[model samples]
Target: MTEKIAVLGAGSWGSMLAAILNENGHEVQLWTRSAAQADELNQKHTNRAYIQNYTFPENLRASTDLETVLTGATEILFIVPAQATRAVATEVDRILAKLGQRPALIHGSKGLETTTHLRVSQILAETISPEHRTSISVISGPSHAEGVVKHDPTLVTVASDDFDAAQRFQHLFMNDYFRVYTNADVIGVEFGGALKNIIALASGALAGLGYGDNARAALMTRGVAEISRLGVSFGANPLTFAGLSGMGDVIVTATSTNSRNYRAGYQLGQGVPLADVVANMGMVIEGIATSQSAYELAQTTGISMPITEAIHAVLEQEETVETAIHHLMTREGQAENG
Candidate 1:
């Protein structure tokens, strides 16, 4: 069956996913906020600013009209930034209400709401009317827009509290080049996706400071451990941390140059100011905000997340990158399993 899918963001990741879906023979509507971008994609079949060197499928439509994008869509995927999820969901709710239609909701974004510290799915649930929401799922893992655009082998996880919904999402995106797995651990999957960015930033900073593979390896290893600890405290399954959305995500984001968080951290390590790093990146660095939220969540939950604390300190300018590294190294040693 050819499903009509609406993608609610035209950023790199969103546009790339829309292209992939179009390739899979699905009818795709990619919504962008800018009329210029919509016109460009419609006329040129290329989102040059976001996904370079790639032409979108001719059948893939781009629009700035939210109503036109959502009209007759079987599924709606929210690919906007985490901070924008609530606002987008509210708008979606109004549209769904006016249309008297309900569609499966999926989110590709990975981060918590800064003040509420709520997961993306949670925010969606709060804003979208229950009657108008079929199911909520999140797609996250090691997949990057740059690699996915090139059709490189990519694997990701789709998680939902409803197992059937997870399987449905897994089926939707799975293909020869893109593999999807189903997981019922929504909390773990979301946290693993969001928190890994913090570690990526830290790893990038370490590399920028001339640290080698050993330091990066250590940071990644310890980073996943803390992620699992904090996630477990929040009712997430501890074993989920070992799966695609957990260790898998951490490895890719923390080590790959494709990661915005890693890039931001690298610049920070080179003594670039946070404001400058953000201004120059041209994309949202999710870890910068996530670090603060994660640190606050840890404090409230009584979980020990030293790596998150260190990254948060550096991002907040409370400590220099060098000082943060030194403090981490000088911390009292504890059992690896603890």
Candidate 2:
């Protein structure tokens, strides 16, 4: 069942998703605010700005005009930054409102909104009209944009409170290389995906400090515990923390050089300024922004997330990474479960 799909955002992930959907025989329109990016994608069939060295399918189209992309799109995939999600979703509401079109909504972006702490699905639900958003689902896992674009073997879960909707989207992106599974626990999946970035930042800091694998392993294991504790407080199933979005995502993001969060943390550990790290990266580092939100959320919910708190101090409160690590290490010991 080939459908018309509009993929908003022209970054690496959006470009790759457009390529995959195009290959799947869907009429895929990639939307970007950058006219240059749109022209390059439509003319040269390459999004070298983000995903380098990969030629996009010629049939995959990109445009700067929002209405051109959304006029008849049956499904919309949001791959923009989490901070940018609400703005794009609001525009989606305006356009689809006029067209009287109801499209399936799936967000591949992960991160809690800064102050609101709203998940991507929650923002979409609150912004888009009820008539238009009968279903809002999320796709998340260990898959990175660079890897997925290269056809790396990747598996992810699509989640929704509406189980049937989740199953429907499962077939949309599933291929031999990119397999999809259905999950009903949207809260656990979103929290897992969002919170793992903070841990990855800490892991990268360990790597930067020349700490061995032992340090990274300990951080990640304890990171999962912190994640599960908070996720459960938010009504998420604790076992979900053991699944793909949690442990699987945490492993890849924390250990891999491809992760922007890890790279940012690595630079922080090397005494680089936060602004410099972010500017040099030339991409959104979700962890830096997410750390503050995660820390604040933990405070409001009275959840103990020492790792998250430490990283938030480093990223937002001007505490040095080394100092944060020192504090974490010197904290009073407790039972393993505690």
User: Each model's TM-score, in the order given?
Assistant: 0.98, 0.98
lDDT of 1 by residue, 104-220 (tens): 999999898999999999999999988998899999999888998788999998999888888877777889999998888999999999999999999999988989999999999
What does the lDDT come to for candidate 1? Answer: 0.91
| Residue 269 displacement (Å), model 1 | 0.6
Question: Over the stretch 103-123, how does candidate 2's per-residue lDDT look in tens digits?
Answer: 999998979999999988999
Total backbone clashes of candidate 1, pairs 3 or more residues apart or in separate chains: 0
Measured by TM-score, how close is model 2 to the native structure? 0.98
